[model samples]
Each structure stands twice: as structure tokens, then as C-alpha cells.
Target: MTANASPRRWLFVLTILVGSFLLFLVQPMVARMVLPKLGGAPAVWNSAMLVYQALLLGGYAYAHWLGRFQIRRQAAIHVALLVAAALWLPIGIANIAPPAPGQEALWVPLLLIASIGPVFFVVAAQAPLMQRWFAADTRAGDPYILYAASNLGSFAGLISYPALVEPALPLAAQSWGWTAGYALLVALVAISAAARWRAGGEAVGAEAVADGEARPALRRQIHWLLIAAVPSGLMLSTTTHLTTDIVAMPLLWVLPLGLYLLSFVIAFSTMDRLVQTITVVAPAGLLSVGGLSLLSSGGGSMMIALSSLAMLFLVATALHGYLYHLRPAPRYLTLFYLIMSAGGVLGGLFAALFAPLVFDWVYEHPLLVLASAMLLPLPALFPWDQWLGLKPRAARWTAALLVAVAAFACWKMVDGWTGVVADVKWWGIVIFAIGLLVIGWRWAFVPVFALLMLGVGGWDTVQESFSGMRVRSYFGVYTVTDDPEHQQRRLAHGTTLHGLQRTEAGKQLEPTTYYGHQSGVGLTLDKAEALAGPDAAVGIVGLGAGTLACYRKPGQKWTIFEIDPVMVDIARDPTKFTFLSECAGDTPVILGDARLQVANQPPGRFDILVIDAFSSDAIPLHLLTKEAIGIYARAMKPDGILLIHISNRFFNLEPVLAAEAKARGWSAAIRIDPSPTGDDFSDLTGSNWVALTAAPQRMDALTGGIRPRKDSRNEGVWVPLEGRARFERWTDDYASTLPILFWGNIIGDRE
Candidate 1:
């Protein structure tokens, strides 16, 4: 049973691939399953990521410690651990109830750790452990190449979950599929262990490899940690940037993470040419695209999103290629991975936890980009010593001049001293090109790059800082902007405009934006008295600048439910947006998730219930599920109307609502309001709203004269649920946005 004759190498590779695939696959799958329970906030995903990173670090440490034992003993212990962990399989979160209000941060991680901790720990260790086993058993090649295979499997799993798995399979099927994969991985591990045992504990280089190489120094280890830390932090920052600023969808999460893993695949592969090419071009990608993204305040959001993703991939590739170049010998493989995982944890902590508390903006994104530039390999562009005598003094003077210029530029831009220069986008491009050429000089490159980031985007940060216009919370970033030209003020969440108001003192009570007097929600409110009688009791799910409050009548009892406390504060403060104070003063506002809060209310209490809760373009899936609809139904009077604000940039949710309404035996009417025209002071924007009621007469009365015509998609206007057979009714057990995503309109929508 010599090493050369044994087939254990392939066995080990298969085991690593299967284990790593399941490891990354379960991440998004379980997170998606728990999204409803956790209220669909992006912070829940971040917290879940932290838990995974911490567990991965622990798993790596365990592998490194187990390296002290003989191969036979190590295999036995790991197999036993895997077997014990399998008891928690058919992987699903245990019936740990949703956390109490305000406890989501603590409880999300607690529940994840309790549900999948043991299983995740075992699978996480497979990569490093199997690689070590290969190093001990074979004398053929470096064992580290197998790491590329592991990441390849990881990339495949992540991409497939969103593109293939999620769209095709429900949660129950995905869970069982993952369980089957885990079982196969266990069998592969057993076979690999038996192969090692058959080698009679005298495989090639078992002792020699361990004693052959010197341990990496503390300085070198720290360098490895820093290199690994940059990409890890950058990955999370990129995810936040896209989801928070562009679109808050789960599909967006997979893009950055999949690219991040793919970088490892490309960097660690046998393709030396590809790695070298990327390493050469990465700095330019960061300088041009990354710098522009930071500086520009407004552009086509899809273009910005694509550019940002490209920048992330290029930067990650260069950083990871450098890491591969610095790899230690096979003897220190587990130790190397352990230190790298530790850096990953620190990076996750900084982006997900620290940045929100320390900075009012998404400052981490540009900061990490700058850090990536600093760490990139600086190849010499010209021979400075030969051309200019005495290189040291010339370098020192050059560095000082660049720093001074960068500082002066930032000062001028931030202080509004550069009036016309700031308006020209080409000026920033020229400066970025100069910065790219200076990468040969470390001192010059870092400062020049930092300056470009500040000059392009620094003024907005300065404006926000001085005016206190931006607020970051667990939900996302909210900015209050005053448009002097339009004589209006707006509250925006990410790229989506939440609410707007006329700036004139007397017009502050008028509703604007999507809630204008003639919009879908507006028309529904206008007819509320006719549909539900005088003095109707109303409930609103989302409190966006409190615009809906303007629709309240004198004797109406209106209540609003909001999840983020920061939003509640902004809406209630009269100086910010006066819709709440000017109209519905002293109205009761509940601070919690809408579904949960509405469920606890007295049954049959409200004449109308409005569902306006959304994060950017994301429809909170939890709110639209059948169970959630049931809860809303229980809280409403028998003939009460349900006004659902389904206007979104990335989803056509009318079909979804129609399907759900059909299942509940409720008649529905959809109103697609035309955009306002010709000096209309209402500031109305086009909107789509669906009204559901058990009483058909009420729907007919509310939708008077707004005949629903069949659209190009053959989707009829005000048609019964039978025409929506292509759409599935979402429930607590299953839902997928794949079928309804507005792919053709992604570029036009500022989601």
C-alpha cells in the first residue's frame, strides 16, 4: 500500500470538493429559510456571516492541533465527529422561535450556532485536514494546489444556489439535498481514512515533511494575515455597497461572494499566465472604476453596480495571487490556513459591525479599496536611480510633494474651493491615470490613490458631515436631501426615494412622491370614506417620512408600524418632514416588525390595512406570505379593504398578490397610476397598487372608471386570479423571487 499506488489522492480531492460545496451552499440556503423569522433585514445576513467565520477559524485551529497525532488517530477522531454531527442533519434551523423585539442581533447568531454549529464545524475542517493528509501521504507535488479545487467547489455551490438551486427547488428540497451531499462527504472521508490506514503508517514524507521546513516567523505570519484580511473585508464591503445602495436582493449577495471565491480558484490554479495578467491589470481596474464609483454621486445605478463588481473581482484576484506567491511549504499548511481564517474573522467584524458604529456613511468600501491599492505589488515603471542621481533623496522629496498635493486637493474639494473643476468628470480620470503610473513608488501611490478617492467623493461626505444629513442603521443608509431647484425635500433609503415634500411652509401638509394625491395609494385613501364609511380605523405598515399621515381625516384613528427606530425618529421630528406633525399629530406609532405587531392587535379593529413596508426595491417576503396575509385578515373587519403598495423597481409583484388573493378567496383590483403631467404641483410619480377585499362591490366602487386593460404580457387589468396561473402563491414554507424579477427593466430602475 505504497503512496504512489494508492488511489487516496483522488478520494481526498473528492471529499474536499463535496465538503466545501455543502459548506458554502448551506450558508445562503439556511439564511433564506430563516429570512421570514428574522424580518428580512440585511444585518441578519452579516451576523450569520460572522458566526460562520468564527466557526471556520475554530475548525482550522482544530485541524492544526490534530496535526500532532499519527494519521490513523486523526482520521478516527474526525470520522467520529462527522458521524456525531450527522444527527442534526436534513439541515434545518431548529424550532427556536423568533427572537423577542430588539434581540435580533443576539438571537440570530445564537439560533444559527445552536442549529448548525456541530455540522458546520466538521465540514469546515475538511479542506485543511484533507490537504494535510495528502501532504503526509504523497511525495508527488505541493499539497496546496488542492486548495484551489476546494474554492472551485465553493464558487460552484454559491453560484448554483442563486442561479440554479433556489429558482428550481423549494426550501424543503434544498435542505434534503444538502443532507444527501453531507452523507456522501462522510462516506468519502471514511474511504480516504481507510486508504491512509492501509499504507501501514509509513507513507512517504510523514515525518520528514513535518520536521523539514522551518516555521513561519511572527512578522511573516502578520503579513499573511494582513494580505488575507483585505479581500475578506473588501468582499463584505462590496456586498453592502451593492445591496444597500443599489438593490437589497439575495441574488446580489451571491455575485460578490461567488466572485470572491472564484478569485481563489484562479489564483491557486495551474494557470500561471492568468494570475500574472490579473496581477498586472488589477491596479488600473481599482484606480479607474473604483475611484469613479466613489466620486460620482449620480450615474446609471446598473452601470455603477457592474463596475463595482468588476473592481471587486480584479482587486481580489491581485491580492489572492500575492498570497499564493507567499505560500509556505506543505508542512505549515494548516497553520497557514488557521492564521488566514483569523484574518477573515477580523475583516468581517470590521465591515459588518465596526463600520456602522464608527461612520455615518459606507466609508468602509472606499477605505478597503485604498488598502488594496497599498498592498498591491509595485513593479518599477522606470529606473529612478540611473536617471536622477541619488535615488533615496529624490524618492523622499517626491513622496513629500505628492502627499502635499493630495492634501491640498482634498482641502480644496471639501471646502468647495474648486467650483468648475469639481464639475468635470474627466479631471478625476486624468488624476486617476497619474496615480496608476505612480504605483512603482509606494509612498506616492498610496497618497495619490487616497486623494483621488477623496476628491471624487469627498465633497459629499463633507456636505453630509456638516449638515448631518445622512444616517446609517441596521436596515440601511437613509439620507435627507433638500432640492432647492424643485422646492422640495426628500427622504431616500439607498437609491429608492421613500418620500418627498414641497419646501414651502404652507405646502408641507401635501403628500408627494409615490404617495401623491392621485397615485395608487392616494386614490385608495381618497375613496376610503366611501368604501369603509366615515371615521374609518386605519393601519399603515411602513412610516416613510410619515407621508401617509397626510391622508388622515379629522376623526380617523390611524396607527403606523415601523421597524427601524431611526426612521421613526426622522418621521416624527417636525423639522425634518412635517407630514406627521402637520396632519396626524399624536398618532400611535408602534416600533417593531409590522407582521408581528399587526398580529398582536385586536381582531377586526381596522377598516383598512396598508402594506407599504419595503427596503429599497426588496419586497419583504415575510409580509407577503399566506400566513402573513392571514394575520392581516384576522386584524381587519370582514369587509375591510387591503391596500398593498407593490411599486418596485426590480419586481412585478402584482401577479404574486393576485395569486395570494385568489388562494384566500378575496377579490382584487390593480391600479397602475399614470405619471403626473403639465405643471401638476402634486409631485406625483407613477405607482402600482393592488386592493384586496372579500367584498367585490367595494373593489368595484374603489376602482371606478380606471378600467384595467390587458397589458402586452397578456396580464389583464382587474382580472380574476385565474389568469395568474403562472405565478405561485407564496407561503411561510416556500417562496422564490426568480420568476417575477424585472430583469428587462433592471437598468432603468434605480434599485
Candidate 2:
């Protein structure tokens, strides 16, 4: 409050802001750097998040311990820790090779921890520690408000990475930029330390008097932990749901995280009215948007994604605002953050580490939604006590039973909606019932809401579980479902159909989905046999039900490089689809990432190489980088062709591959395959494929009389990579999908 202390207070705020910014910025930067090595699975980012949360807990604990010491001693110890952490500076990942087969899950966490552990841990303590240090100065105002500044920096950092930092700087430059920022943070810390030293022993004695206040009870602390845990778990779950099920775009991960941090900013800001308003409306937002998220099933994906994000922000703002309400005095600031961080670690552990192992579907998403509902401050909508004064317990139990029955009836009714009109009517009825429950009885509201959510999606998951139709692994969830009407079995990875097989006795060898015989890869295979004879050596990158294996002829040497063992199992099993068993029987399947595996192969071994490893709509960007292209070129003969399955619902990848082809002096052509009409042995879907060959004559032979067209939407024609302004040559050190993201009306409506 004094004029002399004003400058020191601002200094502490600046230090905390800069430290928090660097803390969040490094998360995406380092994750991007390691993405290629880890096979670019979305789970890799989740694992990285778990490590960050665990380290944050460690940092908060350390800060709480430091709070026990005098201001001068605390400053000295923190300064030493910062200096020690600087030894791992420049911030690039350690020069370690990619993990071998079956080692990615263990290696990803270890790599992230070893690469950024010390620096991250040291910086993670800055917010609480700096607040504690400022609190020691009795003249400084309430230190809780400074938390708003910290998270604002975090929000800025997360958004900046995807929007500005990634587009402007390569990975190495990003690392060095972070290192420079770290150095600036150290300087700021030093200035704060000097200010504390100048305050002398009087300030320390004043701090001891303030620290003698009554401590929060154990029960209150546990409440704080639970309050914090729900939002933390919800943040990760939202990220997983959007990226895995809705859109597999890499930068989409930042939206939920940025909003989660922004919630802290809103909760702790000076704008109390705004926070209060959001808290008031939070319940309605959770029910409406959360219900929609649960009901979402490959339709209105953009709306579903936006709704899920809105739900996360609202739930987080309400919970964090409640945490703000329960915040202890300045003396207990570090302890408060310590408990909150511990809760965060628990939430992250459950979502990122435990959920996949325990659940067959993304059950964590709905379960966390229900938990958030329980934690939220609910309003009493009806006077139940007045209505049933004599036997209130019996009345409540009877009401609960009735609500359950109503929910079951609604579920059965909705399940019978096989027509669009019937579906619309059922949704209208469900919404009307939800509105009644919101006003009729508070106790029954959450249970009914939970039941509706279960009815929409949870019941489907239970069915899948009972039927053993789904399996969840670290890579993703795979579902095997049958369409008895069409006599077809399909393998789906998330929302994208990986492969489809006809159930007729002799039709098992047919190729479906993106691998139909008329597809680009198919045409390329035909040309390969014509050019290199019947015994041409071929390699396939992604094995999805081994659909492309049907194109293999006798005496043709075929090999497969697959990153996920689960996919390999599905493809190899005779009872599954039999594409591999009937076509390329006992084929040699190399287990590892294609980028690494292909590099290990002999030079000029394959006549053609096929890269078909897209999961859902997400293209593992690592496989499309320039270095990956080089590996493919090395493994192919001089005139060999490289076929990349660039079909995507969210991204237009032709430009990216075109740029790479232009840079590498390879001739490239694209084909957009048409979807098959009517029922047949093969259920062909629309697909996009790109073929690149180092030899122009080979490209010419494949293209023949077909002129290269400019329009990408045209079907079954070789498209030329004419317009190059939007394309950037992707490399291991630099790649951005923002430019090529599909901006059409059909944004999230992927087939």
C-alpha cells in the first residue's frame, strides 16, 4: 500500500506473468518437437500433460516448503534452484532416438520428463512463490488477485503457440526463444530478491505475525481438492473427446487448455460481477452443452466440438470461481496452490494414465461430466419438505423411482427413432422433460440429466461393452461392428471407417473403404506391376484391416510397417476381415513407426511404397514432413512410385504434399476417388490419394492420356499441384496445419 512498495509489487507480478507464460509455452513447443518420434498419437500429448501436472505438483509442494523460511532465505534458495535448472537450457529435447516397438507409452513420458523436467519444475513454482514473497510485504495488496495475471499469461502463451509462435519460428528457434525467456525470468527473480533484501528483517517479522492466523481445517482442504479436480479432469477429457472423436487436428488441443487457463483468469479477476454471472449461468450451460456432447455421434461435429468447449469453459469458470470463494488468506497462498496442483495431478493421472486401461470406450468423458455436475452448486427448484412433511424420505425415494422410470421410458422411446421425424420428436420431448426437471425438483435433476446422457451415448457404450465390439488402447479406441442388413462388417477408428468387409463367403478378399481397386493407390499398384513386372517389391505404411493386401499378387513381395499393434492384430486375424489371410497370407509385418522403419530398409528395394496410416480424420503430420519423404524416396527405386493416402475430412493435404514434391524434384499427381453407389461385395467410399515419383516418365506412364486437373474436388482424375501459395514444405523442425484446414461448410461433418 506504500509508495516505496508499489514498484516491488509490480516487479513480482511481472516475474510471475513471464514465468507462467514460459511454463505453458514450452508444453506445446516441446510436445511438437517430440510428436514425430512418438508416432503423433493424440495420447502422446495427454501423456505429456500428465508429466507437466505431476511436475507442477512437485513445484507447488517445494514452494509451500519454502514459505516456512525467512524471505531472504526463500529468495536465496529459489535463485539457486533457477540457476540449477538453467543447466538444461536452450530447451531442445535430448538427442535421443525414437522409441522401439511397444515402447512408445513408457518412452514418451520418460522423454518429456528428462527433456523439460528441471526447467519446468522451477518455473512452475513462480506463481505461488512470488505471491508468497509479495505477501511478506505487508504494504502489498491481496496476493490472490495476482493469480489472475499469472493465468492470463498462461492463456496468452497457449494461444500464441498455435497462432503465432509455431508459424513464425522453427522448433530449434522456439527452444532458444524459450531459453531466452527463461533467462529474462531469472533476471526478474533477481530484482525481486534484491527488493526483498532491501526490505530487511522488519518485513520478515511482520510476515510471521500474519502467518499466525487460524489454518483451514482438513475438511475444507479436501473440499478444495475435489473442487479443483473436476475441472482439471474435465479439461483433459474435453481435449481427448474433441481431438479423438470430433477432429484430430493437432492445434485443436490448445483450445480447451487455453480456455481452462482463461477460467482461472476470470475467476480471480477484479471483475467479480462477470465471474458471478458466469457462475449463475454455469448450470444451464453444463446441462445443455454437456448433454449435446454426450449425444453427438459423427453428426454436427463442429457444433458438438464447440459445445464441448463451451461446456468446459463454463464448468471450469464455476468451479474455479468457487475455489476463489474458498481461498484462504495470503499467508496460506502456497499451501492453497499446493493442494490445487495435487488435485490436478490426480485428475490428469485418471484421464491420461488410467482411463484407457480401465475403460473400453471414452467412458471417462461422461463420468467426469457427471462428477462435475455433482460438484457444481445446485439450486433447490421445488419445496419438497412442504409437500411431504410427514414422510419426506419416502416421498423423495418415490420421486427418485419415478424419475428413473421416466428416464428409462425416454431412453426406450428415443432408441426406436429410426426416422428423422421420429428423432426430432424424441429430442424435443427429451429437451422439454429436461426443462421440467430443472424447475420441478433439484435432487432429481442431476440423476435425470445423467440418465439422459447415458441414454444418448452411454447406453450405446454399454451395448458395445456387452457385445465386446470395442477395444481401447493407447493409440485410440477401435470398434468392430456389423451391418447385418448389408451383410457387411466394418472396423472403425474413432469416427473414421478404417475398413469394411462383405460377409459373403467368397467376398472376404475384396478391398473396401479407401482402398477400393479404382482408388489412386489401386491404380498406382496396377501401374507398378506393369512397370516393374509381377514380382515387384511393395511396402505399406499403415495396415488398416489389411485392405490393400487384396491387391497383392502371387510372387509379389509385400511388407507392412505398422505403429499400433492393435491394428496389426485386427488386420492379421483370419476371423476379423481376412484381407491379409486371403490375399497376402503370412506377410512380413514390421512393428514400429513407418518413418523410422522405412529408413532402416535397404535402398531402392520397393517398386512402390504406400502410406495409408491416417486415423479418423487426423493425418500424423510427422509422416508427411520432408524428412519422412526423404526416407520414402530412399527406400524406393529410382523410378518407383510413392502413394500417400491424403484423404482427409478436416485438412486439404494436397498442397502440403505438392510443396514437398516441388522441393524434392518429384512429379506428383492426385486422384479423388468417387464413392460407390448401391450394394456390392466391396463398399467403396470416397478417397483422396497422391502419387509422387522421382521419374517423370513413370509419372507420365501412370497418368497416360489423363490431363492433370486443377480442381481438387473432381473425382477419379490426376490433379496437378498448380496453386502453391498456401503450401509450405513441412519438415521435422517446422509444420503448421492451420493453413490447410478445411474451411468449407462441411467442416466437421466427415464421412
Candidate 3:
């Protein structure tokens, strides 16, 4: 910037940075606050994400609409809107009633919009609006550079929440801190408004153009829309693909989004050489890392995850850099942003809304990966024209030949993986060699990428997705597969195994998977009659294949509570798995969030209450809160045993439960059934179960009355649960997955 402009320049940059920071910080903060109300389903996060995208589009449109007014008039209106939005100070979830069973689809958006809609809309407009105002002088030296600073602030806010803010302070503190930031933004906006106080300041660049400037051509404008949408859709799709398909790592959801926001920072920055380098390398990333990351995450789940992330960053930066290359002058700045935001919303809709409804698996990830190949700026890796010098007709024929080769290579690759081809490894090399040759040709590159995808594991993913064996619900995607060799059928939520049952005649009656005979819940189920009398009234939350139903006695009255109706269907269908049909065929399955539904159960109704409602590796923070403990305590008989199955690969949930149990003075015991081994290992598995009871003797009975560890080695030995130090007591107001994360366990070769 010129020496005359430093003061004004820094102020405008700071204001945009601050506003952008607040705009992103509110997302995780408010989403954390609402978990208690909505339960910790991954869909809740997806819904919240879609709502934010829609709101952002609205904010950008609002900014574009303001271009019609003079600078002072625009400033006055924005400031007034900011002040009025202050009524939603210390932002959090709204006070409205929680959604009914199937109404969460409607309720989550309503709740989010009602909570922070006004404040978010006002702050979200700051980046584009403030940039436009800064350009009022025409000497502000390319107002577009501030967009880099805006996304930088956005990246910082998103990363800092999980790393610095949430771990350091609770949700309430995060919210009030954001509110304070908003107040400062209001003052900053007023100061920016005062910087240029010329009444009827002919709108910046309102004067006649330099004979060549007008709106971007219709095709160019549409290019901007599509260019913006691919990365936006890929962001969410990549998150789902990595977490659910590759590795069910808790809190990994934030990485894709963080990289996405940072891409704009890199792309829009003044570092032209860096942008040029990423653009050049991105096509290779699409060819090498993109489809390969999805084909088969075989020996390297971690490597696959890292490569996929690298691919996302490279592709996003390259596409967005090209967007910067096509940018218009400052006159149509807000229009450009409006179209960009609209595209973001559309992409978000495709990934978040469209995929879940239309496909059973995360095809959007691979589909967008293909779409990236189509939209990415193609620069020749080598002198294709000089090297080949082929005529147009020859080129077309060669392209057709390449298409056939790609299809054959992909098919062979799949055959190799399935043992149909003798040299699978050679097939991969051939596909890679052919793909590398066509990196500069968009038409040729796409077919290679698509075929290469199927050659890897994309073919299997496609088969499974469309086989009608997978089901999508508000909660998650569940797939039921028959394991004939193991004589069992398995149910899976993402890569995490939900449950499996023996398909054989006699063994089908056994409770397998996490509820093996020696498991804590298994032992408690066996001795429940001794502890709570014969015909014990039992309630089980999370009906995963109804594996625990076999633990029910002839006279025991067992009730199952399941949140997802799709899961219920899978469990109840005898054709899928017979655990529910054979054991609890007549049992009633209550639907809704386990916590809310448990709250409505008649007092002292259950003699043995079990909380087992986990979906894959992600544990529900809301279910383990003290308030939820109170609900569980009220729903069970005074001396009844409360069993919780904390079988999560992503979290060490003992601390959350240990803290609540300590506070309530409940007797809690921890049991570890180390994942089973030998032939039964595939069906029966180890589980971490915590048994708590208000009555000490009941705990003693569950623990074998001061049991000795001298029992059979295969059986789990109950030990007193020790409270973890310096742990947060999760509540409706505050809960974070950072504390209890099994960071090392995030990557593994699991089914």
C-alpha cells in the first residue's frame, strides 16, 4: 500500500479479519451447545453445516443488494442491522422445544437459524461489504487482496476452537467471547463508515468505465459459479469419505473444512508463483492421490487419509486460484461474491443434502473427485503438441483408444483385487502410467480417473452402495453383510462394526459381538435376576442387531430403545440378522433420542437399564452428561443395575462417565473384555463396559461380590473405575471430543 494509505488499509483489514473470525467461531460453538438437545449424530453436524452455507449465501446476497445504495447509506443500514442483532447476545441454541422423533430434519435448521441467524448474517457480510467500502477510494490498491486476510481469519477461528478455545474454555465462555468480538466489530464498522463521509459519494466506480469494462460475460459468470461449487461440495464429501469410509476418526470432521477455508487464503493471496505451482501440481494430485485414495484403503488407512487430504488441498487451491485469475474489477466485487456464495450453497446442498438422500454410500466424494478433473485448470505437463504432432482425427482416435484402455485397466485392477487377475499390482502401474500421460487433456484425464477409481476399491463401494444392502437415515449409513465363511451376518455403521450374529441354526441364539458372554453387560444380564429379582424389567438403548436381546431371560421383560428407524428395520428383519427376531421378536422398540425417550419412561420401570446407543466410533457426549445420568437414574428402579457399553474406538469414555458417577455418588465398576481372539474373534469381540448402580450390593453382585480375578481368562474381570483427573464434566452447555480422543487409535486396519 502507498504511505498515504497504511492507516486506512490496516483498519479495514483488521475489521474484516475480526468479522471473519467471529463468523466461523460461532459454528462449532453453537453446534457444541446444541448437541445436548439434538444428540451427537453425525447428521446433526451435516445439517448445521448446510444451514450455515445457506445463511452465508444469504449474507453475500445482502451485501450485493447493498451495492445499489451510496457508501454512507449502506454503512448506516449495516450498522443498524448489527445493533438490532445484538439482542441475540451471548449466542446459543434457541429455547424452543426439542424435535419430535422424525421431526429433527425440520427442527435442526429452525433451531440453528433461530439461535444465531441475525448475528451470523450480519457478520458474514463483513468480508465483501467492507472490501467494497475500502475500494470506495479506488486507490486502496486492489481491495481483493483483503479476501486472503478474511479467509486467514476464518481458518484461524475454525482451527483454534478445537485446539485452543474449547480445550481451554467451556462453551459458555466461547459464546460470550464471540459476543464481545461482535461489539468490537460494530464499533469497527462505524469507524470504517466515518473514514469516507462524503454525502452522495458517487458509488465507488459509479463513473463511466474505461471503455472496456462491464459485467462479466454470461459464460464467464457461470464459470465462476461452477468453479466455486466443486470445492465446496468436495469439502463435505471428503470429510464423509475419510471418516466413514476410510477411518472413523472422531473430530476428523474439522480437517476438510479447515483446509477448504485456508485454500482461499492461499489462492487469493498475492503469492502468484505459489498459486501457479499448486495449480500445476493439482492435476497430478487428482490423478495420483484422488481416485487412489478411494479405490481401496487397504494396508494404509493413515496414508490414504493423508493423501486424500493432500488431494483436497491441492485441488481446492488450484481451482480457487483459477477463480482469482478470472476475477473482475472492483466495480462488480459484490456480484462476484454473491455468485460465489450461491455456488457454495449449491455445492453444500449436493454433498450434504443430495448425497445422503440419493446414494447409500459417499459417492459424492468420488463423483466430486471426477468433477474436479473436469473443472480444474489444465496446463500441459509437457509439450503435447510438439511431442505428438498428431492431427485432429488421429487425436480423436487416440482418445478413443485411451478410453478403452482405461476401462480395461480399471476392470483388470478390480479383478486383481478380487483375485480374478494374476497381476493386480501391474494393473495399477499401467493405470498410473496411462493416467499420467493424459493429465493435460480434460477429456482423457476424466475417463482414466473414473476407471482408476473402479479398479481400486471404488468398484466394491459402488456395488455395495447400489446393492440395496445399505440404508441411509438421519443418523447414519448402515450396511448389512453376510459372512458365510464365518457363519455370521454383520451390521456396520461406516467402517465401525455395529454388531454381528451367527447365521447358523444353533449359534444364532447367542449374543455375540460387543455383548459376548464374558462382557460386563453380558455378566450383568446373566445376574440381573439375582440382583433385581426374577422377571427383571430391562431396558436397552441402541438396538444394534438386538444382540443383547439374547441376554433376556424367559420371564424378563426387556424393552429396546433405538434412535434410527433404519437401524430398527435392519435389526428386526430376520432376513438381515435373526438376533432380534429370535430373541426379542415381540419386544417393543421405542424410537427417538435415547435420552429424551428414556426421560418419558414411567419412573422405576426398569430394573436393569443399559445404555448402548453408540453409532460407530463416535460416542454421544449428550448421553453421558450429568443431566442425562439423572434421567437414567429416575427411569430405573432404586437398586437396579445401570449398564453402559462404551465400546468406542475413537474415545476413552471412562472419564466422562467416571466424573458423572463420582458426582452422583453412584457405585461404578469398569470391565474390559479385550477384543476376542481365535475363530470366534470375527463374531465375538471385546468391549469396554461400565456398570453403575445406586445400591452398593447390586454393584457387588455385578462384580461377583468382591470377585477374585481367578475366574476363566476369557471372562472380563470387573474393577472399580477410577475418575480421570482434569476432565470436563460434559453438560448441555459444554462438551468437547478433544479430551477423551484416542488419537493414536484413529488409524487401523479394522472391518
Model 2's TM-score against the true structure: 0.92
Candidate lDDT values, in order: 0.79, 0.80, 0.82
- Tens-digit lDDT track for model 1 on 577-650? 88888888789999887887898999999889999987767678889989899999999999888988877767
Which prediction has the highest TM-score against the true structure? 3
Task: Provide the lDDT at 57 for model 3.
Answer: 88
Candidate 2's displacement at residue 261, Å, is: 0.9
TM-score of each model, in listed order: 0.93, 0.92, 0.94
lDDT of 1: 0.79
lDDT of 2 by residue, 1-751 (tens): 5766454677888998999999989998888888766666656777888889989999999999988878788889999999999999988778667677668778888889889999999999999988877766766767788899999889888888988999888998998899999999999998888877755322422324455568899999999999998899888888877766776654576788889999999899878898887876777777776764554354535777787899899889989999998998777888899999998888888888899889877778888888877887665344454555737676667667657675765566467534455664576456536534453355676777676676555555566687766788877888888888888999877776778888877876777777777889888886667868889999999898888888888778988998788888888778777888878877899987788789899999999999987776666788999988998999999999999987776778878888988888888888887777776624888888888999998888887844657564667788775547756689999998778777773454444
lDDT of 2 at 235: 89
Q: Which ten residues in a row have the lowest lDDT in candidate 2?
A: 200-209
RMSD of every candidate to native, in Å, equals: 3.0, 3.4, 2.7
